[model samples]
Target: MAFSSDLDQITRAASGDRQAVSALVNRYSPGVLALATRMLADRAEAEDVTQEAFIRAWKALPTWEPRAKFSTWLHRVALNLCYDRLRKRRDSTMAELPERVDMALRPDDALDQSERVQAVEGAIAALPERQAAALTLCALQDHSQAEAAAIMEISVEALESLLARARRTLRTVLMERSEA
Candidate 1:
Protein backbone atom coordinates (compact mmCIF):
# COMPACT_ATOMS: atom_id res chain seq x y z
CA MET A 1 0.00 0.00 0.00
CA ALA A 2 2.96 2.30 0.46
CA PHE A 3 3.45 2.41 -3.28
CA SER A 4 -0.21 3.36 -3.69
CA SER A 5 -0.14 6.25 -1.29
CA ASP A 6 1.26 9.81 -1.19
CA LEU A 7 4.67 8.45 -2.12
CA ASP A 8 3.62 6.93 -5.41
CA GLN A 9 5.85 9.42 -7.19
CA ILE A 10 8.81 8.63 -4.98
CA THR A 11 8.11 4.93 -5.35
CA ARG A 12 8.44 5.38 -9.06
CA ALA A 13 11.61 7.38 -8.62
CA ALA A 14 13.01 4.66 -6.35
CA SER A 15 12.39 2.15 -9.08
CA GLY A 16 14.40 4.31 -11.50
CA ASP A 17 11.63 6.05 -13.38
CA ARG A 18 13.18 8.97 -15.20
CA GLN A 19 9.94 10.91 -15.30
CA ALA A 20 9.51 10.64 -11.55
CA VAL A 21 13.09 11.70 -10.98
CA SER A 22 12.70 14.65 -13.31
CA ALA A 23 9.51 15.71 -11.60
CA LEU A 24 11.11 15.53 -8.21
CA VAL A 25 14.10 17.51 -9.42
CA ASN A 26 11.92 20.21 -10.89
CA ARG A 27 9.86 20.49 -7.73
CA TYR A 28 12.77 20.60 -5.29
CA SER A 29 15.80 22.00 -7.11
CA PRO A 30 15.01 25.65 -6.43
CA GLY A 31 14.73 25.09 -2.70
CA VAL A 32 17.90 23.02 -2.64
CA LEU A 33 19.75 25.66 -4.62
CA ALA A 34 18.60 28.42 -2.28
CA LEU A 35 19.56 26.48 0.82
CA ALA A 36 22.96 25.61 -0.61
CA THR A 37 23.64 29.15 -1.81
CA ARG A 38 22.69 30.64 1.53
CA MET A 39 24.67 28.10 3.50
CA LEU A 40 27.78 27.99 1.33
CA ALA A 41 27.60 31.65 0.25
CA ASP A 42 28.95 30.55 -3.12
CA ARG A 43 26.64 30.25 -6.09
CA ALA A 44 28.97 28.04 -8.11
CA GLU A 45 29.60 25.69 -5.21
CA ALA A 46 25.93 25.75 -4.35
CA GLU A 47 25.04 24.63 -7.87
CA ASP A 48 27.47 21.74 -7.60
CA VAL A 49 26.16 20.85 -4.17
CA THR A 50 22.57 20.93 -5.46
CA GLN A 51 23.42 18.55 -8.29
CA GLU A 52 25.22 16.21 -5.90
CA ALA A 53 22.33 16.25 -3.46
CA PHE A 54 19.87 15.15 -6.16
CA ILE A 55 22.23 12.47 -7.37
CA ARG A 56 22.58 11.13 -3.86
CA ALA A 57 18.84 11.20 -3.38
CA TRP A 58 18.42 9.20 -6.54
CA LYS A 59 20.91 6.63 -5.36
CA ALA A 60 19.37 6.42 -1.91
CA LEU A 61 15.82 6.31 -3.18
CA PRO A 62 15.66 2.55 -2.93
CA THR A 63 16.04 2.81 0.83
CA TRP A 64 14.06 6.00 1.30
CA GLU A 65 11.46 5.89 4.02
CA PRO A 66 8.19 7.79 3.91
CA ARG A 67 8.36 9.11 7.45
CA ALA A 68 10.17 12.39 6.76
CA LYS A 69 8.93 14.66 4.03
CA PHE A 70 11.01 14.45 0.86
CA SER A 71 11.91 18.12 1.06
CA THR A 72 13.26 17.75 4.59
CA TRP A 73 15.38 14.80 3.58
CA LEU A 74 16.74 16.69 0.59
CA HIS A 75 17.55 19.75 2.68
CA ARG A 76 19.46 17.63 5.15
CA VAL A 77 21.41 16.06 2.32
CA ALA A 78 22.22 19.48 0.83
CA LEU A 79 23.30 20.84 4.20
CA ASN A 80 25.66 17.92 4.69
CA LEU A 81 27.24 18.53 1.30
CA CYS A 82 27.63 22.22 2.10
CA TYR A 83 29.25 21.34 5.41
CA ASP A 84 31.69 19.02 3.70
CA ARG A 85 32.87 21.79 1.41
CA LEU A 86 33.03 24.22 4.30
CA ARG A 87 35.28 21.82 6.15
CA LYS A 88 37.75 21.26 3.31
CA ARG A 89 38.24 24.91 2.58
CA ARG A 90 41.05 26.49 4.59
CA ASP A 91 41.39 30.13 3.65
CA SER A 92 39.09 32.57 5.40
CA THR A 93 39.24 34.72 2.28
CA MET A 94 37.72 31.85 0.35
CA ALA A 95 34.18 33.03 1.03
CA GLU A 96 32.67 34.70 -2.02
CA LEU A 97 32.14 38.43 -2.01
CA PRO A 98 28.59 39.71 -1.88
CA GLU A 99 26.77 39.43 -5.19
CA ARG A 100 27.05 42.52 -7.34
CA VAL A 101 23.88 44.58 -7.64
CA ASP A 102 22.52 45.08 -11.14
CA MET A 103 20.91 48.41 -10.36
CA ALA A 104 22.62 51.61 -11.33
CA LEU A 105 23.75 53.40 -8.23
CA ARG A 106 25.68 56.39 -6.92
CA PRO A 107 29.34 55.63 -6.24
CA ASP A 108 29.30 56.37 -2.50
CA ASP A 109 26.02 54.58 -1.88
CA ALA A 110 27.13 51.48 -3.72
CA LEU A 111 30.37 51.38 -1.80
CA ASP A 112 28.56 51.70 1.50
CA GLN A 113 26.01 49.02 0.65
CA SER A 114 28.64 46.62 -0.60
CA GLU A 115 30.69 46.98 2.56
CA ARG A 116 27.68 46.43 4.79
CA VAL A 117 26.59 43.39 2.84
CA GLN A 118 30.06 41.89 2.94
CA ALA A 119 30.29 42.50 6.67
CA VAL A 120 27.01 40.72 7.24
CA GLU A 121 27.99 37.81 5.02
CA GLY A 122 31.35 37.52 6.71
CA ALA A 123 29.70 37.47 10.10
CA ILE A 124 27.41 34.68 9.01
CA ALA A 125 30.33 32.73 7.58
CA ALA A 126 32.06 33.01 10.92
CA LEU A 127 29.21 31.38 12.86
CA PRO A 128 29.40 27.78 14.07
CA GLU A 129 28.04 25.47 11.39
CA ARG A 130 25.01 24.33 13.38
CA GLN A 131 24.05 27.79 14.52
CA ALA A 132 24.44 29.20 11.04
CA ALA A 133 22.41 26.38 9.55
CA ALA A 134 19.67 26.91 12.11
CA LEU A 135 19.46 30.63 11.37
CA THR A 136 19.62 30.17 7.61
CA LEU A 137 16.77 27.68 7.54
CA CYS A 138 14.51 29.33 10.10
CA ALA A 139 15.13 33.01 9.42
CA LEU A 140 15.94 33.38 5.74
CA GLN A 141 14.02 30.42 4.33
CA ASP A 142 10.89 31.22 6.34
CA HIS A 143 10.65 27.62 7.44
CA SER A 144 8.69 27.04 10.60
CA GLN A 145 10.81 26.43 13.69
CA ALA A 146 9.42 22.93 13.87
CA GLU A 147 10.29 22.32 10.24
CA ALA A 148 13.76 23.79 10.62
CA ALA A 149 14.40 21.75 13.72
CA ALA A 150 13.40 18.61 11.86
CA ILE A 151 15.63 19.53 8.95
CA MET A 152 18.55 20.15 11.29
CA GLU A 153 17.81 16.97 13.23
CA ILE A 154 17.46 18.83 16.51
CA SER A 155 14.73 19.57 18.99
CA VAL A 156 12.77 22.81 18.61
CA GLU A 157 14.19 24.10 21.88
CA ALA A 158 17.76 23.58 20.66
CA LEU A 159 16.91 25.36 17.43
CA GLU A 160 15.70 28.36 19.44
CA SER A 161 18.93 28.47 21.41
CA LEU A 162 21.01 28.42 18.24
CA LEU A 163 18.91 31.16 16.72
CA ALA A 164 19.39 33.34 19.77
CA ARG A 165 23.14 32.80 19.75
CA ALA A 166 23.44 33.41 16.03
CA ARG A 167 21.40 36.63 16.32
CA ARG A 168 23.50 37.91 19.18
CA THR A 169 26.70 37.12 17.31
CA LEU A 170 25.41 38.81 14.16
CA ARG A 171 24.41 41.89 16.13
CA THR A 172 27.79 42.22 17.76
CA VAL A 173 29.62 41.69 14.47
CA LEU A 174 27.50 44.27 12.63
CA MET A 175 27.83 46.81 15.40
CA GLU A 176 31.61 46.40 15.38
CA ARG A 177 31.64 46.82 11.63
CA SER A 178 29.74 50.08 11.93
CA GLU A 179 32.04 51.40 14.63
CA ALA A 180 35.14 50.52 12.65
Candidate 2:
Protein backbone atom coordinates (compact mmCIF):
# COMPACT_ATOMS: atom_id res chain seq x y z
CA MET A 1 0.00 0.00 0.00
CA ALA A 2 2.89 2.33 -0.64
CA PHE A 3 2.41 5.48 -2.64
CA SER A 4 4.29 4.23 -5.68
CA SER A 5 2.54 0.85 -5.73
CA ASP A 6 -0.87 2.47 -5.47
CA LEU A 7 -0.06 4.74 -8.35
CA ASP A 8 1.18 1.83 -10.43
CA GLN A 9 -1.88 -0.25 -9.67
CA ILE A 10 -4.22 2.63 -10.33
CA THR A 11 -2.60 3.30 -13.70
CA ARG A 12 -2.87 -0.36 -14.67
CA ALA A 13 -6.39 -0.76 -13.35
CA ALA A 14 -7.48 2.35 -15.16
CA SER A 15 -6.34 0.66 -18.32
CA GLY A 16 -8.70 -2.26 -17.55
CA ASP A 17 -6.09 -4.65 -16.25
CA ARG A 18 -8.00 -7.37 -14.42
CA GLN A 19 -5.04 -8.45 -12.34
CA ALA A 20 -4.50 -4.88 -11.25
CA VAL A 21 -8.15 -4.60 -10.34
CA SER A 22 -8.01 -7.83 -8.32
CA ALA A 23 -4.85 -6.72 -6.57
CA LEU A 24 -6.41 -3.43 -5.59
CA VAL A 25 -9.54 -5.13 -4.34
CA ASN A 26 -7.60 -7.71 -2.35
CA ARG A 27 -5.47 -5.01 -0.78
CA TYR A 28 -8.20 -2.52 0.11
CA SER A 29 -11.56 -4.31 0.45
CA PRO A 30 -11.01 -5.59 3.98
CA GLY A 31 -10.29 -2.11 5.32
CA VAL A 32 -13.24 -0.70 3.44
CA LEU A 33 -15.57 -3.46 4.70
CA ALA A 34 -14.34 -3.11 8.26
CA LEU A 35 -14.84 0.65 8.23
CA ALA A 36 -18.32 0.34 6.78
CA THR A 37 -19.27 -2.43 9.22
CA ARG A 38 -18.12 -0.35 12.16
CA MET A 39 -19.94 2.72 10.93
CA LEU A 40 -23.17 0.99 9.87
CA ALA A 41 -23.23 -1.75 12.56
CA ASP A 42 -24.98 -4.03 10.08
CA ARG A 43 -23.13 -6.71 8.17
CA ALA A 44 -25.52 -6.80 5.22
CA GLU A 45 -25.61 -3.03 4.84
CA ALA A 46 -21.86 -2.84 5.29
CA GLU A 47 -21.36 -5.41 2.54
CA ASP A 48 -23.57 -3.38 0.27
CA VAL A 49 -21.62 -0.22 1.09
CA THR A 50 -18.34 -2.02 0.41
CA GLN A 51 -19.56 -3.17 -3.00
CA GLU A 52 -20.87 0.23 -3.87
CA ALA A 53 -17.59 1.83 -2.81
CA PHE A 54 -15.62 -0.42 -5.13
CA ILE A 55 -18.02 0.25 -7.93
CA ARG A 56 -17.48 3.95 -7.39
CA ALA A 57 -13.73 3.36 -7.30
CA TRP A 58 -13.85 1.56 -10.63
CA LYS A 59 -15.80 4.42 -12.13
CA ALA A 60 -13.43 7.03 -10.77
CA LEU A 61 -10.23 5.27 -11.85
CA PRO A 62 -10.33 6.51 -15.39
CA THR A 63 -10.29 10.13 -14.35
CA TRP A 64 -8.40 9.73 -11.11
CA GLU A 65 -5.74 12.20 -10.18
CA PRO A 66 -3.13 11.33 -7.61
CA ARG A 67 -3.97 14.32 -5.44
CA ALA A 68 -4.50 11.90 -2.59
CA LYS A 69 -3.54 8.29 -1.88
CA PHE A 70 -5.85 5.83 -3.57
CA SER A 71 -6.74 4.23 -0.27
CA THR A 72 -7.53 7.61 1.25
CA TRP A 73 -9.76 8.49 -1.64
CA LEU A 74 -11.46 5.11 -1.59
CA HIS A 75 -12.09 5.31 2.13
CA ARG A 76 -13.41 8.85 1.82
CA VAL A 77 -15.82 7.60 -0.81
CA ALA A 78 -16.97 4.78 1.45
CA LEU A 79 -17.36 7.15 4.40
CA ASN A 80 -19.51 9.51 2.33
CA LEU A 81 -21.64 6.59 1.20
CA CYS A 82 -22.08 5.57 4.82
CA TYR A 83 -23.10 9.12 5.65
CA ASP A 84 -25.67 9.03 2.88
CA ARG A 85 -27.14 5.76 4.17
CA LEU A 86 -27.17 7.08 7.71
CA ARG A 87 -28.97 10.20 6.62
CA LYS A 88 -31.53 8.14 4.76
CA ARG A 89 -32.09 5.89 7.75
CA ARG A 90 -32.55 8.95 9.94
CA ASP A 91 -35.11 10.32 7.54
CA SER A 92 -36.97 7.05 7.19
CA THR A 93 -40.03 6.50 9.35
CA MET A 94 -39.50 2.73 9.66
CA ALA A 95 -35.87 2.78 10.78
CA GLU A 96 -35.27 0.92 14.04
CA LEU A 97 -32.17 0.08 16.00
CA PRO A 98 -30.82 -3.43 15.53
CA GLU A 99 -31.19 -5.77 18.48
CA ARG A 100 -28.12 -6.93 20.34
CA VAL A 101 -27.28 -10.64 20.17
CA ASP A 102 -26.11 -12.67 23.15
CA MET A 103 -23.27 -15.08 22.51
CA ALA A 104 -23.38 -18.12 24.75
CA LEU A 105 -19.83 -19.36 24.91
CA ARG A 106 -19.07 -22.49 26.85
CA PRO A 107 -15.88 -21.35 28.59
CA ASP A 108 -16.03 -18.49 31.05
CA ASP A 109 -12.89 -16.93 29.58
CA ALA A 110 -14.31 -17.03 26.07
CA LEU A 111 -17.60 -15.60 27.24
CA ASP A 112 -15.81 -12.77 29.04
CA GLN A 113 -13.75 -12.03 25.94
CA SER A 114 -16.79 -12.02 23.69
CA GLU A 115 -18.71 -9.77 26.03
CA ARG A 116 -15.81 -7.32 26.16
CA VAL A 117 -15.58 -7.18 22.40
CA GLN A 118 -19.32 -6.77 22.08
CA ALA A 119 -19.34 -4.03 24.69
CA VAL A 120 -16.62 -2.06 22.93
CA GLU A 121 -18.25 -2.47 19.54
CA GLY A 122 -21.67 -1.49 20.86
CA ALA A 123 -20.19 1.56 22.52
CA ILE A 124 -18.42 2.53 19.32
CA ALA A 125 -21.60 2.08 17.28
CA ALA A 126 -23.36 4.43 19.63
CA LEU A 127 -20.78 7.18 19.18
CA PRO A 128 -21.28 10.34 17.14
CA GLU A 129 -20.53 9.50 13.50
CA ARG A 130 -17.45 11.70 13.11
CA GLN A 131 -15.96 10.48 16.35
CA ALA A 132 -16.55 6.87 15.39
CA ALA A 133 -14.97 7.41 12.00
CA ALA A 134 -11.97 9.12 13.53
CA LEU A 135 -11.39 6.34 16.06
CA THR A 136 -11.97 3.61 13.52
CA LEU A 137 -9.59 5.07 10.95
CA CYS A 138 -6.76 6.03 13.31
CA ALA A 139 -6.98 3.35 16.00
CA LEU A 140 -8.72 0.30 14.59
CA GLN A 141 -7.67 0.56 10.96
CA ASP A 142 -4.14 1.84 11.77
CA HIS A 143 -4.19 4.69 9.34
CA SER A 144 -1.62 7.46 9.81
CA GLN A 145 -2.91 10.60 11.48
CA ALA A 146 -2.35 12.64 8.35
CA GLU A 147 -4.00 10.06 6.14
CA ALA A 148 -7.01 9.75 8.41
CA ALA A 149 -7.43 13.51 8.64
CA ALA A 150 -7.21 13.69 4.87
CA ILE A 151 -9.84 10.96 4.57
CA MET A 152 -12.18 12.73 6.96
CA GLU A 153 -11.51 16.12 5.32
CA ILE A 154 -10.55 17.57 8.66
CA SER A 155 -7.50 19.08 10.26
CA VAL A 156 -5.14 16.95 12.32
CA GLU A 157 -6.13 18.92 15.40
CA ALA A 158 -9.80 18.33 14.73
CA LEU A 159 -9.15 14.62 14.26
CA GLU A 160 -7.25 14.51 17.55
CA SER A 161 -10.14 16.25 19.28
CA LEU A 162 -12.59 13.74 17.83
CA LEU A 163 -10.37 10.82 18.84
CA ALA A 164 -10.03 12.14 22.38
CA ARG A 165 -13.78 12.57 22.76
CA ALA A 166 -14.45 9.16 21.26
CA ARG A 167 -12.00 7.51 23.65
CA ARG A 168 -13.49 9.26 26.64
CA THR A 169 -17.00 8.30 25.66
CA LEU A 170 -16.00 4.67 25.02
CA ARG A 171 -14.23 4.56 28.37
CA THR A 172 -17.25 5.86 30.25
CA VAL A 173 -19.66 3.51 28.47
CA LEU A 174 -17.52 0.41 28.87
CA MET A 175 -16.83 1.19 32.52
CA GLU A 176 -20.53 1.47 33.24
CA ARG A 177 -21.18 -1.79 31.42
CA SER A 178 -18.46 -3.56 33.41
CA GLU A 179 -19.78 -2.15 36.69
CA ALA A 180 -23.27 -3.31 35.79
Separate clash counts for every candidate: 0, 0
- What is the lDDT of every predicted structure here? 0.78, 0.86
Report clash pairs, candidate 1. Answer: none
lDDT of 2 at 99: 46
- For candidate 1, write residues 1-180 as lDDT tens digits: 423442777888888788887888887899889888777777899999999998998887888787787888889999999888887774555755345333323234445686556555556767777888988898878678877998889999999999999999877755665555
How much RMSD separates candidate 1 from the native structure? 5.2
Give the per-residue lDDT of model 2 (tens digit) for 1-180: 498898999999999999999999999999999999998888899999999999999998999899989999999999999989988988985655444434442234355776656656777777888999999999999899999999999999999999999999877765665455
TM-score attained by model 1? 0.77
Ten residues in a row with the worst lDDT in model 1?
Answer: 100-109
